[model samples]
Target: MSSKLEQKIAEFRITFIAEFNDKLAVLTKLWSNARTSQSLEAVKKFRFEVHSLKGSSGALNFLTLSNRLGIIEEKIAPCEEQINSLKTVIPFIDRHMNSMNEASRNTPNSLLVLQEAASLLGELRDPQKNKEEITPQSYRDIKIALIDDNENTSAVNAKLLAGFGFTINQFNSIEQLEKVLQKNTYNLVLIDTDNSTNPSEKMFAFAVKLRTFDTDVFILSSSSSFENRLSAVRSKVNEYLLKPVNITTLVSKIRKNFKIDLIRPYRILLLDDQALVGSFYKTLLEDEHVEVLAISKADAIMTELESFHPDVFLLDMHMPNISGLEVARLLRQQAKYDYVPIIFLTSDDNIKTKLEVLECGADDVISKSTPPNIIVQQVDSRIQRGQEIRYLASRDSLTGVLNHGQIMDAAAHSLRLSKRQEKPAVVVMIDLDHFKGVNDKYGHLGGDKVLVSLGQLLLQSVRDTDYVGRYGGEEFMVVFSNATPRVIESKMNNILTAFLHINYTVDKQSFNCSFSAGLASSTDHEKLSELISSADAALYQAKDAGRSQICVDVLNK
Candidate 1:
């Protein structure tokens, strides 16, 4: 593998150095056009050559020649003010090309040219290079407590939440829950109640006590009377869910309240009119584990680009019919891709043209002759930062997971692809049983720890191709591409078990938690909303059937 990579690198280096003189000749011709007609296109074309040669020359240890070429790149910058400067610089470029070619292959006659280029660089690059500045920038398992005097309900709820990426513990009494709270924390707590006209004093007292711990407390009653509601408020209960609970509503609340930062694979779009060059570059990038879509034509790219949805655009600075500048402008005009970064791999060195490209909505520009290592680093760093920016804007801050809108957007995208490919897709809706009880007993801070924990767990546990996001409160949505119900069921089981075993602590006290999940596949519903609704319905079934389990919509049907 190492040898193969080395061989590829060696061949790439040679190819990287190919067409040097030919490019230099092109630069000379463009220089003439720029000098005579003051043509910006000529300078734009000129950069395609000199900028590449500049890097190649520098890479081969020819500093003076490279720097000299660099000067011409700046001179031909597509600016009206600098267009006239080309005439004077043309002679400079001419003499250096001659001097560079005349020099012995082994020893460069660079001492004089190097000094002159150094002087030119000092005048050109100072106080004007500010392109790579991005202003600064995980999910954890959620722990929950289901406090119900009824063993059946509490146990079932605990297991239900556990299946969905929450760690839940069932306590039959507030006293039992208090002992766990003393040492362990929970993000939510659920107190089960009956439809009696008068509130149970003991249950109300426990709810108030749990509030002191800063946990989110909820009372689940079989009644929704005003008196019952007022009693909950007076008891300091955080929320009141009428039984039988709509599991989807409860899960949505959880998702909205908690956060998780999920990871998804990012890809790049490479636009180079040169098919061979684009192919080789694509291969090089792929070897580094970068996903890239390389295109040689500027026409008919919008649709492909829309579907590809690249994180970064790698473009050749100039093309024949439609220049890179025009393409960049077109991309900027679209709201959908406004945040994606555009980087030009060009031979143009004109400071003006660089600024022009920037104005066209590009992120950065690099010479094509840059070392592969540096180029790779450049692409990687930009992708990382661009993704960070993109995700931050759409994710829940604490958990770093997609928020409702973002997750739904992901769902819509998946639906489109799955429908097109005629492949299966799945949506899993998860909820924690008696979640408010966990929050109430553990206090808000402890509750937060649980949410963060659950968020991190889903992100780390799921496949890179999967999408994890908080649908609301403690409820989460996971969308799997090209996956069957069986696949989802197996995946959910592992996540549930993992949550069930996570030991949580508050003030050195320890406890555990669990969750429940409901999964629906594309076979059940073709529309995005219908699919989610189906999964949500299945979630209710899981809770009804007893928590800490997963319910499949198709299987039930």
Candidate 2:
């Protein structure tokens, strides 16, 4: 992230906070009137405000505040909805109120709950207040506790998850887990419920207890009954997965749940025969948070190109043997590098030489004699504008992931690279389970929110090198480069576990929806088209077997 861009987002936060406070004041006034008079109109108006606040706060990532507001919203009186009694909602309004004028607002029943909720909103928004809550999660350093009576399953899952950069500890019972959790903190816990005949019952009873320790608890059980699933929800379980779970799916779920905001710096590959000139330029760009790899020899270009993956290339127009023009032409020959911005650094200001440089496929020709700060500004602006253009052209308008055509292009490029590297590339085809029902129940707007959340989760769960693209409505595609077939399938399941936990609200009612994914890898197929077809076929298998599950390509498995 650039300093300017960060500043702009900060400005947006300021505006949002100001607007939020103003609305909150109005909401409080409405609540006070409703609590005193029990007026139906005031009750309806204040309830709408609560709904709006909950939605907006969650949308802006003020999760702690939004969740509290959600709990308060759910307390809306049923009698008031039926117009049976206006007095029914007074208790709720009083309990959730934060009245500045009323001294007795903090009664035993009221508890200043709304006051705390409001304070939490400001705390989450301020970086200095409870900084850890607002900071990017340390995904790599995630610690997990797994409780499974089956020691074999625990050992196997623990080893696999630990191999993929996680600290996983296995406990045979809730008693053992509880003892360890007293002294050590974990990000999440996996409960395999097989101790009793009812599978999830005993472990499900422990979920609320585990959550009290400030750790997310996920239940893995063989029971797929609706009652048991509902029980898991009531227990405040983060996710409920079926038994015979895919190890990779669990890995992906944990990973996606612990998403981090990784800001990638602009990369500039500078080639200048003069050591002093190259070093000077590198230092200037580095100061601006740009990654600069200065190479004197043109032969080193190919070696560094694969690793550095520069966003912009700065080539000396006059090199020892090869000029910038020749290098630009060579790079332009590759289809993938066609969009990579190349600038020529020249000592000569001759119009003919500049024209020649542009003719050879460089985006622009800049004189080496130009001011250093000016050069930095020019390079930075070009990279920003080019990214903006690419974003507009290739991203899905609604979800902001890569559009259909761009994803296809990415898949093609990914396959070619995977083949060259002698590594497998995996493709996962995802579709929201029973999405039409969501549209029917909550309307299309609600359905769109689900898709947007899914798209964001898909992008966040993977590395920057991976590709996430919107296939169409309620459908998506993700491509993982240099992935193993079975291994990638596990990673592909990350979004599935994460998505189901996303609660969507409509008209004060909240619900969560899950997605099914089909994962196929280059282990069995070579062509991109074939790989995608297999993945699509596997996706249908998942949908057929049961929704909210991931199916791996049969051949690859």
Tell me the TM-score of each prediction against the true structure. 0.58, 0.50
Q: Over the stretch 1-557, how does candidate 2's per-residue lDDT look in tens digits?
A: 23443444344435445555555678778777777766667666666666556544443334555565666566654535764455665565566554422423334332222333233233323443211221235435788888887888888777656544468888888888778777998889988886643345667777888778878888888879899889989999878889888654565455435533323567899987665456656765775666899998888898677646677888877665566788889999986676778887654446887889878888887665454445666887777665555555777765667899889988887887778778888999999989999999988756766776777677778887888999888899999988876777677666677776777766656899998999898778878889999999999999999788889989887
- Off-target runs (Cα >4 Å) in candidate 1 are 1-6, 13-268, 275-293, 299-311, 333-339, 369-381, 507-511, 554-557
Compare the candidates by lDDT and give the number of the best one: 2
lDDT of 1 by residue, 1-557 (tens): 13454455445435544544445456557666765676777666666666555644543334666666776666555354566666666676667656655542333332332333333223222343333332211113556788677766666666545544567778766777777778998767877876333347777877787777867787888878887788789987777888887543465445543423323345889888766567656765776665789998888678675357688999877676678899988988976577788899876656987999878889998876565556767988888777757765777765557888888988888888888778878999988767787788866545655676777688877776678888999898999988999878988999999988877765545667677899988876768989988899899989988899998995534
lDDT of 2 at 141: 70
Q: Candidate 2 — what's its lDDT?
A: 0.71
TM-score of 2: 0.50
- Which one is best on TM-score? 1
In model 2, what are the clashing residue pairs, if there are any? 248-490, 252-494
Q: Lowest-scoring 10 consecutive residues by lDDT in candidate 2?
A: 127-136
